[model samples]
Target chain A: MLQYSEKVLELFTNPKNVGTMDGDDPHVGTGVIGSPECGDVMQLQILVDDQGVIQDAKFKTFGCGSAIASSSLATEWLKGKTLDEAMAIQNVHLAEELELPPVKKHCSVLAEDAIKAAIEDFQKKLEGRTDKAELHSPRCCEKLNDCEGCGSHGE
Target chain B: MKLPIYMDYNATTPVDPRVFEAMKPWFCEDFGNAASRSHVFGWKAETAVAESRETIANLLGASPQEIVFTSGATESDNLAIKGICEMYAPDGGHIITCMTEHKAVLDTCKYLETKGYEVTYLKPDTEGRVSAQQVADEIREDTVLVTLMLANNETGAVHPIAEIGKVVREYRARLHSHLFFHTDATQGISKIPFNVNEMAVDLLSFSSHKMYGPKGIGALYVRRRDPRVRLAIQTHGGGHERNMRSGTLNTPSIVGFAKACELAAAEMENNVAKLRHLRDHLEQGILQNVDYVKRNGHKTERLCNTANLSFGYIEGESLMLKLRDIAVSSGSACTSASLEPSFVLRAMDVPDILAHSSLRFSLGCYNDLAEIDYVVEKVATAVRELRELSPLYDMALRDNTTGDTDWAQAD
Candidate 1:
């Protein structure tokens, strides 16, 4: 078994705020990151108020134990924080807090990217932008997958 | 019973008390090299080794002379594949095997490939059985060996080795004549019914640890008559094991292996029935209670002690963590120190999501109905909990949560 921290195991077994929070609600900013191939797919949604403060955060992650723990921690950190404060939550910080091994650090990166993408989606609605907001850049190898003749891959 | 029950019997089984008792003498008072001909210790050790060899041979319906002891199934596999390839390399360098074989066989074939040998890895059907026709189609004049697994470790899909054996037998008599057949029956030997003559496998491999015997001991069945299959020796020392393999024999483990095989031969019928009862009950309960669950492998042809299931929308790693009371395996390669989904399930064309969601729960002689009940209840609960946390499952339940999101446009 992977050496998951106790907190990671606890949050995974009893993840907080797992269900969706009215995706149609204008105050909701939903961010879906990750892919099936990468073995992680996270959809994080935030409930923000007029003060630009996150009132509540909920998520659903389809991945391994660490991925679920990472997204769960992201949601827990998102609630009650100002948008700027939430933005400051880096993947590295999450990795350190979760004590995730280097191989699993990408799960934390997905969590952080989900935060940015969700915030951008909410701001896009606020600006009345009709075009869909671009989400996270696919991590490393998944990015170069579309290019031919370049077999070099990221870890 | 221990709180966290061991359900991963396919991985390795605990040594039976009888086997342990049989081995204790060899490890202590009877400790002597079988090759020592001058003393009573050597005679006693050789007697024990001969008896154990007879026991293993009896279980597989082969002669005692045909059984050559090795460290374990991995060594048996390496010895069989490489030995056969080396023996016939001057005449033929082509071998045929399947993709789902244990790494021992696959990696050995790969090493042979580096030495200018050709190998054909046949793909199994959805149920994980490589057909006899597939093997027959690949066999050629240069095909010196055909190595296939008798039972898959992950799915427990029992290949029709008898059918494949028939094909090889026909080819050996009518065509190539020198083409030999070997099977890594590491998962099959005592767990399922097997006879070397019926399977027509010239050489066969099996491990002791997988059959309630001690680890670090196994055997390779070599044909002695009817064309008399041959292999080049991999380990050259002491000129033991009929010049096929050379090393000081593991007397204790061999004795233990024989004891385990004797017990299995005596009790296999009843144990298999009990295991089947518990396995079927668990499979039915989990399937009836859980949602989007699919069973891998053949419905009836699988081993009675094995059950491989894919619980959709639930990550197998998370499920294993939550179902802590029942030890089992997941498709997550993290457990195996990798990140790839199970290649066995991938070969079956199970979707990536379900493949990652797969779990292998292998029942054993020690397991009872109560433990099966524990697994059925705990697994259903765990799957429900993980699916609740799963976004795809949640979105699947809620009709249009993703109506506006464009997945392809993310790039």
Candidate 2:
């Protein structure tokens, strides 16, 4: 039998936030990774604020106990961090938190990747809004005095 | 400490107390090489060896002259399969076997295939069983042998060897009638009846370790009058076992094996009945307490002491780790590498999710009702908890039928 770390076993025996949630929420960023062929799958969701800070996170995993525990622990850790903070979270830090065995380090790595991936999605969407605002600036419409009242500038 | 339950009877068995007693003297004061002629040492060794051979032959219903001893069932299987192939290679050159045969037979067949012998591997259906008619259908004019396991190691599904043998005999009436029938009876010896003539097998393999005897020893039964069956000698040191297998016999282990066979023969009916009762009780308890559990193998044709289950949505390795107090095996103990599920289950077309969740509980001589009950409780709790945490379970529970929830679909 594989000897699990105390924290991994604890989380495995009593996993936290282990169910599906609404990933389409305005505040939530979703990250889904791993294939069924690989024998491990995880779906992570993070609730973040307008200020790019994470308020809460949850996950559902289809894998061995180590993978399940890693996702559970990863979600709990990401709940109070800023998006950048979550982005900076390393797989090693998650592994250490769970004391994961070397063989199961991949599970922790998956957890970290899912975190970074979700945060990056939020950052990308934030950047898209800024780029759209800049493209429609009033300074660029100086010659068009009635541009404010004109919802459609051209037919 | 509580005695850890021994459910790995297929791996090896505890030496029976009586067999151990019979073997004690041969290890010490009476030790001598049976082949050393013209001395008290030789006489004593010869007497012990001959008596042991007679005891074993009686159990198999064969003359002592037909039994050839080897290191174990592995060597016995090798000597039977390869030896026959080598003897008739240039003239006859073909063999037939099932995919579910033990490594001893399968590997030997593989080696033979590489050495220019054509081997046709028959695949069993989803139930892990093959029809005798299938064997008859596959037989060709060039085929020299038909070998199948008397009972499968993982599923414990018994093959219709006697029927298959009868078909082979009818089809190959003459032409050297070079067709030989061999069954690896290692798993079937004590649990099921094995009459060589009744089974119509020309060659049969039996091992001691699987039947409450010492390891590193076993025997092969050959019909002395059969001109169609003879092995090309592989080992040639001192020409022992009528020049078939050549090694100085370990008297103590063989003696223990013989005694174990005698005891098994005597207690066959009683033990089979008791083990079946205990086995069914364990199965019933799990079925009563756990949902989405499935039994593997043929319900009626399976070994009396064996049962395998697939705990839907739970990994077998996790369940095994949780139930550390009890020892058990997954399907194909050798082939089922860690977390890989089982090849046998895969061949049966069992879905990968459920295959990975399979567990085997094999009962033995020492297990009783108390042990069975305790195992049932631990397994139920562990499987239930494991299933509750599985996302696959949540998806499966929705339909109440466990349809493949895009589980096997690769992304």
Candidate 3:
């Protein structure tokens, strides 16, 4: 058996914030990372408030005990943090905190990737909403009528 | 019942108490080098060693002169493969083996390849079986040796060695060439019926630890009649074991190994029946309670005490961690230093996902029905719990598929 720290074992046995959020919700961001072929796949989701603070976080992982513990601890650390603060959390921090050996360092790397991907998804969602709003606005309509380069609107 | 149940007997078995008792005198009271032939102590040790050799030889249906003791099965395999290759280098330089063979044999063949020897590694079918026809087809004029295993360690799939042996013998006679057959019977020695004569095996390798004996002792059976097998000595010093293996005999472990063989031969039938019943109960319970579980290996031709299963949508190491009270092994890459699943499972064409989810439960003589029952309950519960936490399981439930994600997109 791999020597795991007490904290890692505790989190793995009774992980915090483990579930799925509505990916369709504009306030919810979903990040899926890793591959099943490699024996690890993690899906992390976060519910962000209007002020861009993470109100809730959840994760589901199919991997080793260290991967599960890494993602579980990632969710616990993500709750109530700002998107920037969550981005600041690196894999080394998780590896150090979990006392993971070198062989299990990839699990922490996956956790970090999941955190970044969720933040990117949330940012992309905000940008997509802005674009949609601008497309339906009177100003965008006026610009569309004047611009011949807007081929879809001209047709 | 013990809190942590042992079900990984394929890895290694606990030494039997009776075998230990038989070996205790040799460790202290009869401590003398068997080669020191001038004294009473040497004579006593030599006599004990000869008796142990006779017992081991009897179990394998061979004479005492044919058995050559070594450190363990690994050393025996190296000796048989490399020894034969070097001895017959003048006649031929080709060998045939399976991809699912143990590393001891596979790596030795690989090392031979570096020395300009040609080796044909045949792939096994989905049930981890290679046919005799395949062996016959691969035999070339230059093929001097055909080495395959009696049973796979990971999946417990028994190969048809007798048929392969017949094919090799036929080719040897028809072509009037020097062709030999060997089998590493470490896993199948005591669990199944095996006779060197019936199998037509020229060289056979087996270990004591896998059969409830002390570790650090094993033997290789070299045929001395019909078609006498000559092997170039791999170890050269002091001329021990008839100038094949050159090391002082481990008297205590050899005695323990002989006792283990005697006990296994006596109680094999009853033990096999009981182990089969317990193994089937465990397999059935898990199959009935869990979804998306696939049993690996040949369904009917497998070892009675082995059950290799792949539970979908859950990683094997995660499940093993959850089922900590039950000792078992997994094919998952996460369990090893390498990032690949068991090569034996891969050779059998098990997909990467399923291979990562595989577990091997090997029962032993000491395990009881009640322990199997506990394991079943624990496994079912742990699988259910892990599935709940697995995103892949959720995806499977949503789409009604096997949760197989395209690797190109999953990245």
lDDT of 2 by residue, A1-155 (tens): 45778887788778897766565455667676554334455667787887777878887766666778889988888878887678888878988888776556667766776776667655655555321101112321231232222222221
Q: Rank the candidates by lDDT, best first.
A: 3, 1, 2
- Relative to the true structure, how large is the alpha-carbon lDDT of every model? 0.83, 0.76, 0.88
What digit string (tens of lDDT, one per residue) describes model 3 on residues B281-360? 88888877776887789888889999999988999998899988889999998787666688999998898888999999
Docking class of 3: acceptable
**Model 2 CA deviation exceeding 4 Å by range:** A3-11, A14-17, A29-32, A35-38, A88-155, B1-3, B331-339, B399-411
DockQ of each: 0.42, 0.10, 0.28
lDDT, model 1: 0.83
Candidate 3 Cα misplacement greater than 4 A, ranges: A129-155, B90-92, B403-411
Candidate of highest lDDT: 3
Per-prediction TM-score to the true structure, in the order listed: 0.94, 0.86, 0.93
Error of 2 at B356 (Å): 0.5
lDDT for position A57 in model 1: 95
Give the alpha carbon lDDT tens digit for every residue of B1-411 in model 2: 255887878778899899999899988888988988889987898888999899898887888988999988888888888888777665448899988888789889988887888998888887778889899888887888889998888878888888997877776685545778888999999999878877778888999989999888999998776433689887888999998888888889988999999999999999999999999888888888776776777778889988878777666666776677898876421123233456666767777666767788888989989998999899999987776666557656766766543221101
Per-residue lDDT of candidate 1, residues B270-379 (tens digit): 98899899888888888777867778888788888888888766677878888877889987644444566788888877766667778998988899888888888899
Give me the iRMSD of candidate 3, please. Answer: 15.0
